[model samples]
Target: MNRIREIFDIGAGFENIIEWLTEEADWLFDFIALVVEGFLEGVNWLFHFPPALVMIGLFSLLAWRVAGKGVALFTLIGFLLILYMGYWSETMDTLSLVFSAVIFGLLIGLPLGIWASRSDSAWKIMRPVLDFMQTLPAFVYLIPAVLLFKLGPVPGVIATLIFSLPPVVRLTNLGIRQVPLEIREACRAFGATPKQMLIKAEIPVALPTIMAGVNQTIMLALSMVVISGMIGAGGLGNVVLKGITQLKIDMGFEGGICIVILAIFLDRVTQAFTTKDKS
Candidate 1:
């Protein structure tokens, strides 16, 4: 056992690789920082630019439309409660982080998923990568994110994106690949191009599954908010963190309640989308 350990020296090997990457990948880090910053700014603006009341009304209307009156009412009351607790701004910041991560996750995950669905080689490559992403502890993502983006909401968003990305990709690939072979053959027999078959038949059939992925991704992003807060991401996570440090039970309770409310609200809204698609 000692000899095998000495021969392998996995820790040393891992450390060496990390050191090499850090030394050689400065440009890559800068590029990621730029892209993350752009997304962070856009999402932040979207959540922050409008007055809080207007934003609340808009979200309430959206919840009503998507999830029906019950969810809408809950959303209104939840937001009002957060506002009354003086955590409105923090909640908004958390929402911004989540939205930004989801948008980017979808943008990247969907295409990769589609590609993986269409090609055996791509699927093989992505399978292990997705496994690694999904299996790693969520907090581990924050380290690279902080190193690349140097903390703040950008790092938070990046970490959240990494953590939440795999489900969508995996589900999208599953959904598309699960398309009935007979249907695919029929489309080909009808002289449909690959693109047409994909656009008209595969994606539509697969949408429900994809939407489920979206719901999962959003939930994962929300779960990461507090972890991200540790690295200066701010938001309700920060409030919770403060409460933890100061031993303020009331503050912690308020933050926890708000987080739960937001989670339920988002889960319902996204699930509604999936339900609508199925209907």
Candidate 2:
């Protein structure tokens, strides 16, 4: 055992690599952290700028427009419950983190998905990488994020984005590839360029599948944001963590209920887009 330990200390090797990166790439990491923090603050400001009631009404209106009266009514009731339970601010804080993460995720994922879909080589390269990313323990991501960006929503957003990114990329590639060959041939016969064909034919027909990916990304980001509370990300996650450590069952349960409510609202709204696309 001693000889084996002396021959190979893989954990230490990984730590050394992390330390080297931390020292050598401090400037780049700082710039990224600053950008994430700025975006987070902007989102927080927007969420907090209006009165809670006003924001609730806006969310309900959006739901009605996108999903239907049922979801809208549920949105109104759920948000009111959060407000009544004095969790409005916390809920918004968590929401800002998730929203920021999802935006960043989609920005990066969309391009990768498109590139992979267009090229066999790119798809081959990305497949294993995506598989590794998806299968790695979620907590492992937090370690690097924390070491690079420290505590708070900056690291939270970074971790959430990475954790949630794969689904969108995978689905986008799948969606584009699934576009009918006949449709592509017709577009080509009409002298449609690659870009035009992709935008008009492939993307439009594959929209529902792409939307499903977006929905999954949103769901993953939300779950990660809640977990990020472990590192002081704040919001309902903090509340739930507190309940766990302090044995406040009621508090924890309420926080969990809030999370469920938020998740259902987001899931339904995004899924509605896919439904509309199919229709």
Candidate 3:
């Protein structure tokens, strides 16, 4: 074991980095807790009154416009399933948590994606980080999340965000890279600055791919919603978790169905949004 360890150690200095990372993990956890608290409060504020229904209606309308009848119908079914399963409140809680987490993912992922697009060094640096993030067991994230954020929707959202962010960052970078060099050159020939080119040419062309990333991110986050509930994330997940703990198979199964419906609804809506023709 000693000989094997020495041979692999080389001069990488990984042991030192690992030690430092372990020490810093607590600070990272605290920061995540603070952000999650702020985000949950914001979500609560937005959905505080009847106005939330308005947002829901608008979302439905936008979804209908993009994906047409099929997706809209699916979304309606998802909404009704929540109401039917007696999981409306829990579903709403989960939805709210997911909303906040996805927003956080976008806020952080987009810039990292853009940076990775511009620099190969950034991509190389982020690649291993993303790999580690995804490969780490979901329960591992729950440890710090529970430690810093306590048991509730907030920690759940933080855990979901950490687990789900890599896909969006990677997809966004890939989307930007897929933009044709000729289009970029054409924009430059027209005296477009880097910012203008990115905003006008790159983003518009890359929107579909980025939307695909967002779609994947949302799906992954939703999948974790129920798991997170084990630590205090309310919603259908809580229902399902309760069922499991109490050995009530029906409750767990019903809750799982509700989640599946919600997942389909979200996927259709986001897909419609992404595929819509801007022209």
Candidate 4:
């Protein structure tokens, strides 16, 4: 049994191949880093552009409009708590990271999902890939991400994007597939072009499901953003990490409460959007 296991041991070979690729792929990594950095910078600037107070006011108003008074109150309290805890900047940084990941994830995943919906072969190919992405331990994404982009928000964003992408694609595909065949046929009978059918009939109906997917993507991105801080992503996660390193239980708890508050706020807002669309 030992001899047989030795014969099949490919770990060394895998390591060697990875080492070779890492050495040879410097240019690829550099290019990716440049693009990701640009995106991160842009999102960071957007999040920071308005004074924090103004941003908070706008967000609170949006919550009231979309999610109702209860959620708006919660949003106001949550932001205030984070600000009072002196983690406002870190919270903003985390938000920027999550938003950037969602933006990129949607840009790529939505098109792929739509394509898969239209082609059986494409769906077949995408299924296993999405399964692999979704089923893989989230931490595994950071390994290659760190290798490629090194430590910082770049790698963090890359990891978050990869980790959060599968849900959007899968949901988008499911949404389109779930559309009633009768509706499709009626559109065809009405002489609707494929583009027109999709834009007019299919997408409108699928919007709720797609938005649910977007919500999931955002949540997953937020979770990954926190974990990515282990690699120096620098956000509320960093504060939490610092608390852990220093054995500051109160600090850790404070950071954790802030994270939970933010999560609830985002979850409520997205869910509200989904519910509103459905209604």
What is each predicted model's overall lDDT from 0 to 1?
A: 0.90, 0.93, 0.82, 0.90
Model 2 residue 132 distance off true place after TM-score fit, in angstroms: 1.8
Model 2, 1-279: lDDT tens digits are: 988987788888878888898999999999999998999999999999999999999999999999999999999999999999989999999999999999999999999999999999999999999998888888888898889898988999999999999999999999999998999999999999999998889989989999999999999999989899998899988999999999999999999999999999999999999999898
Colliding pairs, model 3: 90-235
lDDT of 3 by residue, 219-252 (tens): 9899887789889888777899899999999998
Q: Name the better of 1 and 2 by lDDT.
A: 2
Deviation of model 2 at 120, angstroms: 1.7
Q: What does candidate 2 score on TM?
A: 0.96
Off by over 4 Å in 1: 1-7
Candidate numbers sorted by TM-score from highest down: 2, 1, 4, 3
Q: Which 10 consecutive positions of candidate 3 have the poorest summed lDDT?
A: 47-56
Per-residue alpha-carbon lDDT of candidate 1 for residues 245-267, written as tens digits (9 for 90 to 100)? 99999999999998999999999
Which of the two candidates, 1 or 3, achieves a greater TM-score against the reference? 1
